[model samples]
Target chain A: MPKIAVVTSAFFIASLISVPMGPTSVHLLLPGIVGVLLGPAAFLSIAVGLILQCFLFQFGGITALGANALMMGVPALICAALFRVLQNGDRRRVVWSGALAGGLGTALAAIFLALFLATAGDNFFAVAKLALAAHVPVVIIETLVSAMVVSFLFRVKPELLSLPRREDAVAVKEKLEAEAKESESSS
Target chain B: MNTALSWPESLLVLAVLLAPLLLPLLYFILYRRGRREGLVAPIVSLAEMAGGDSFFHRWHTGLKVGCLLITCFLFVTLRTIPGCLAGLAIAALAVTVSGLSWRRSLARLAAMSGFLTLLIVMLPFSGVMQADEKSFSLAFLPAALPLRLSGLHTASLIVFKAMAIALLMEPMLATASLAATLRGFRQIGVPVALTQMILLCHRYIFVFQQEAARMWRGMRVRGFTARGDWASLTAIGNFLGMLFVSSFERTQRVYEAMLCRGFTGEMPEIGSEPIKRHDIGKAVFWLILAVAPLVAERFLHDFTQFFHK
Candidate 1:
């Protein structure tokens, strides 16, 4: 649970560092990155981000929050699964797979948004279509951004991208603690 | 407020009257030389307002949460312009009565203007045309365009409904402390774990934003200008990766500190007074009044029709 809290917080913070890209500010909505890092916990992480986005930024609405969560979460789960399947130990493989997952996650979210809007009534069909079309550029941009991020992590901290098993985290923590104790005694 | 204007004219009047509410946004945009709080002002102000000794702050958190949820429901179902206006007025009244500045609420509405503008632009051309209505065609477009005045009406209704909901949120959120509000969620049968996680996640956002600002300053001092080129992208990517790494280490340290302090997985419940009968009565009364427009739209349709006539 503590680890969960940390990972969610990190992702939430990382998503906030928006850069001015032309007229629009682009922040990393790393649902795909989070999905890959956290796997099944992707849904929870995405939900937390969406909730904060709602209250803090008013990006998504309270009424559509559940719908937004499902939209982003489903794709996140898919991307996480895809990342695992497509990943090997190769750097290029990691980047390409990450890029694919990132782009597809956004595309899937757009589809979900369209579906939600479509459900409102026939009158929303045009808005739905326009919304989906609007996300095409986002897909491309997320692909590039995710690729860069994946490449960076691959070079710097590969361990962070590894699937986090509960037993593994516990074992790792225990080992680190033991090592720290031994170092202190020697010193 | 003009009774003699047609529906569209009324909308135009409303838009004109509401235009000045967007000046803060314009000031924020063009000047870009102000406080530049970036969402913190509202969060901090709301938190401070939550501690105020007002009627709303004194209301049972559960009742406020319940009514907020109901208002969200009513927002979606509301179809008529009058209903939306009534809902908007109710929200405005709530904000005024609670003694919170209307600026944040207005700013929120302004924040949504871009999307609303998009809706206005796109929706008018997308609707299926009625047989009785004349279609407007553009020389630049194919003959299949379904552009009609009715689509504008639907789009406008959506815009108004959204504004009403957004206006209502400021009061709903500020009425109680965030923890108390989450506790209200727990009282209403929303999972305690989920609410707790939201609270934790929300807390760290402020922490991270502060970190991010410092990091941005470091970059800016080193002359990092954002551009649509590879260099800018790479710099941002590196910054993000660095943020994540530091945040991850911080998280571990935080967890260790919590463990040292005998941390449990459960969040300690904040002390809250039990709901009194009078509180329940007040909640019921306000909630009924909140939904009065909806009831009017439904059961009292004939009465509204008499006015329309």
Candidate 2:
């Protein structure tokens, strides 16, 4: 339970520290990509990064840390998974996926905040409704911001469109080539 | 004494009026000359400088929490009009004396508070303007519910006023804490991931602004002035679409780099000290300074009533 508290605290802090409006919104994509590239371990690392942020910056409240981490971190993980699925697909699709993920992540965070507030003894439905309504403008703003970050990355570094190359791909190719050479020698 | 406005209410109004003017004066006197340090540092320093060792020695975490709780209680009970103004003043003073320069601290506070005030003032007006009213097409008209403006029911008006004030307070508090977090992080050794995130976001703000500018140029070039709704939507959509694509690619690369650097499961700390005694003392002193006006206002109200009687 203590470990959970610490983990949640770290996650919450990282999420909040990254929450401010800036170029870091793109960083939201990092966790997801990292997760896809490196697996679940990346998610834990991202959470740690987020927690470190909270500790250093006090961006998110200690009480609400768990929710914040899940809110931001979950989307990042989802985006990374989606990126992996579409790694071999068109760049346009990748861009759209990222945009959707970014927008959804922000909207989800707002919703989570509302839910957390409600459960913490505030008027649940009313707070949720108000929070949802209030966040429309913010979501729209973030969506646009997210989209821009995606496009900027696309223009400058197209290679970033793909996941980091897996070592298995090269190894498999080399093994196939060696097999072919052995067959030719036997014949 | 007329029961129309509470003592806290009147004090809050005065604080609202005075904070803008007083904070700037505080900033100019203490922080304007400091070249290297940012705005918040000087005000905090001044607070410590003013109170000396006593300010630094007394450290009670509970007191700081208590002050915050009191501020929140005042907010919920009194609503935004008075409670928020008072809270803002207190928070500003607290921040100023927390070892930050007056200029940076005041500027930070003012920017945050000012944005909140503007949003509160504008939201209602904007809502009213955007409302599907047959009359008064101007966006400047009030958008408040009819039950609020009828002036016939005094109690209803009070309730409406209180609700509006409370609504205003929530966002203001959020913004204040957000600013504090940003400042606090910089003071401590910020983590690499966090720092990277902030830098990327900051950079993209300029990137988006440039995108908007280019869209405007395109509009001008095509002989399509932004005079109509169609043009406005076109310009906005184009800019948004372009921005999304760019940011997506950026994230992909940032991730690849993180993986290369052995970013395993946690952001290792670069090391940071806990809040210093002086910082806490300064925070408390300013907290008291913020509350002083409220106490004074209560006394003044009684004094005025007694003299008048």
Candidate 3:
């Protein structure tokens, strides 16, 4: 849970970095990678971060906050599930899965954003269309960037790539303690 | 009333329609240099102004959160132009009474101008015409794309509602410390775990932002400036991955240290005052203000008819 919180914090910092997309630039959302790493906790992490941004920072108004959270968070959960189902840990497979999840996640977020705007009525159709069109560059960048991160993690820490189960986390900690005692006695 | 306009007259109407939106959009860019635009950095010090003994500062936090939050939702539901205007008036009054600076409310308005301006521009031409609705067509431009007045009406409602809620955000949120605000949320039935996550994430956000700044400086020193290219994206990808790896690795130590200090899920309260009778009165006052727009949305046509009679 603390790890989830920490990752949420890091996501804020990561999103501050702007990437040029043709004439306009966008900060990285990376919710796809966040979903892969945090799994079910991604939505919670995303929502909490958004609430802070909305109310405290006032970056987005209160009404749009709920829409924005669903826009980013729902796609993240979907991408996480998709990646988990397809992941086999092969180097090639990880990269491809990561890329697919990243692009699809952002595309889904854009679609969700458009849909949310459409709730105002058919009058918003054009604005919705423009919103979807604006996200084209974001989808492209996320695909390449997500693939890079997945492959890098596959080399650096293979275990972190697969979702870390709670039971396994506790078990591993106890195991480390037991091993330390054994080594102390042997030495 | 065959008020068909000539080409020049049509152009004048279009300019009048667009001027309100374009002027502010221009001002936000030219005057402020778009201070809040494109930046995801948290404005942490915003709540520092809560220390002043304003009416909102004295209000009960839990009730404030609940009432104003409900009010924000109601503000957006207004369909009638008159109702939306009424909501904005009430919101502006609330801001004045709350004793927060108008500048803060202006900042909130600035954040949403770009998207709202886009809506204002596109809605009229794109909206499908309905019975009992009005539209205008340019003399020279294609007759196929008549600008729907209903679309303009809806777009105006969105703009007014959004601005009202944006203006209200300062009085709603900045009147109390963030911890108090979360506690208020929790009191209003937001889950404990959820509130905890918000508080925890907020705390660590400052810490991590500093760390990222340090890392960014190192990257800059190594001649890795961010730009609109593959190299910058790749560098950012690497930077993010490194952050995750480091954050994950430190968690074990972090957890153990937490456990040693008897870390529990329950957090201490932010020390709020007990709700008074007048606090409930103030809350009731806000509830009425919030509900007025909805009432107008439901009956404003009939209301206008009665007045006409």
Candidate 4:
């Protein structure tokens, strides 16, 4: 099991650096994308990368590291799940999924932040409203970016698309089929 | 003790203003200390590409978005009834003409308007309760401390104060966040190639989401639903793993393709034309506009004191 401290720190750094940008937003998206394709292990890798960025750049506040991590990480996880559900050969679907995921992810982060602020005795509704408002444009920008990237992937490397899905399924299928064929031949 | 403003009031105002500036500094100095260990080789080409005009355009868009929030805060604080009405009209117009999906916008507008109205209505009620003249003391607190206030007026004052503080803080925070990101990038010596890669990654999030959605619809048609079993969990696991691998591989291929196109590490420079003297003058003009009211209010009270003497 990965240490909670490491994961928390990684999330803190990623949120600080990633949350400010319009498109090409980083942090949880990277880990989320990684986790989607690479399994839960990828979370650790991305988390490490985030930790690196945070320490070097001082982007996100340490006090809010756990909250930040949960914000970005949870969304990334959702996006990954969405990617799985929406995985198809169609380019448009990929784009839409990515866009929706980006927007939803951002909104979720904003809500989480708002709630955190509220619990801290900041006016809950006001803070949440502000966060949601600030994130609207960001979600739009991220959506566009997500669509473009997914489209690009579809065009160039179709095999990479199948890798994560293929890892567990294809192997089992092939092995099972091979065993069946061997038994038939013996019979 | 001789200051024109009471000490507590001054302290409150200072605390509100200082929050934005101090928060980022704290983030940088303390939180960033442990982040340097995973520094990868800076991808120079990616950085160069990201430095281009397109990248800056995105940054500019972000700045404008920040400005919009500031405008909202200002509108809330400078609550001239006409201004508020005008803002409501504009929001209505935006709802009608934005050419985007109306459902979300309408929902947001309704929520915001409702909240504002609620706050407005509740103020008088709260005010009545808090206006009682009373003296109270908590353990370990000074017994002579006076805490007299009208609830409604105080609530109204707080609402306006919060709006004012937000107006002042929003832009500052946006600028600080942006500057910090840029400075951090520069300081860490991120390679141009990596910068470009990062930008591309940012861009593709939207792209892949659409792709994912289509895939999901197809799966739904094929009768795949999670009914809380091991199979569902496995299916979910596979889906996530696949998305990540695909995205990463796609990024690698993108780099390869860029290499084939004679990609250099320099992004095209993009900025609004050099700041015109008029623009600077206008900015200065706004700064004065923002400060003038407060300054006048201060001096007018002093002038009244002098005349009375």
Candidate 3 DockQ vs. native: 0.47
lDDT of 3 at A12: 72
lDDT of 1: 0.74
Maximum-lDDT candidate:
3
lDDT of 4 by residue, A36-113 (tens): 333344444444444333323322322234566676666667767777687665667765665566567666667776
Model 4: lDDT of residue A147: 51
Interface RMSD against the true structure, candidate 1: 2.8
TM-score of each: 0.84, 0.41, 0.85, 0.36
lDDT of 4 by residue, B185-237 (tens): 43335444433333343344334544444554565677776443445433433
Backbone clashes, candidate 2: 50
Give the lowest summed-lDDT range of ten residues in model 1 chain B: B37-46
Could you arrange the candidates by TM-score from highest to lowest? 3, 1, 2, 4
- B1-309 in candidate 1: lDDT tens per residue? 111344565466446434534645664675445665441133343475687766678878887788777887886787676787788788778888888866677667776776777777677677666566644444444557544556666777777888778877877777778888888878888888888887877777677777777887888789987777888888877777777777778878888898888878876786976998877987888878788988887875664452332
Superposed on all Cα atoms, the candidates' RMSDs to the truth, in angstroms, are 7.2, 12.5, 6.1, 17.2
DockQ of 4: 0.04
Worst 10 residues of 4 chain B by lDDT: B37-46
Candidate 4: CAPRI quality band: incorrect
Best by TM-score: 3
Model 3 pairs whose backbones collide: none
| Candidate 3 lDDT by residue in tens digits, B1-309 | 023568898888677556546635654565566464322354555566788787788889999989998998888777777888899999999899888877667766766777777877788778666655566777866777777766676678778898888888888778987778778888899988877777777777777777777787788789875676878777877777887787787666666787788877566665666889999999999898789888867865775342222
Write the residue-wise lDDT of candidate 2 on B5-123 in tens digits.
34566455335433434544565566565563210111121112333222222333333334443443443333222433455545544443354333433444333343233323322
Pairs clashing within candidate 1: none
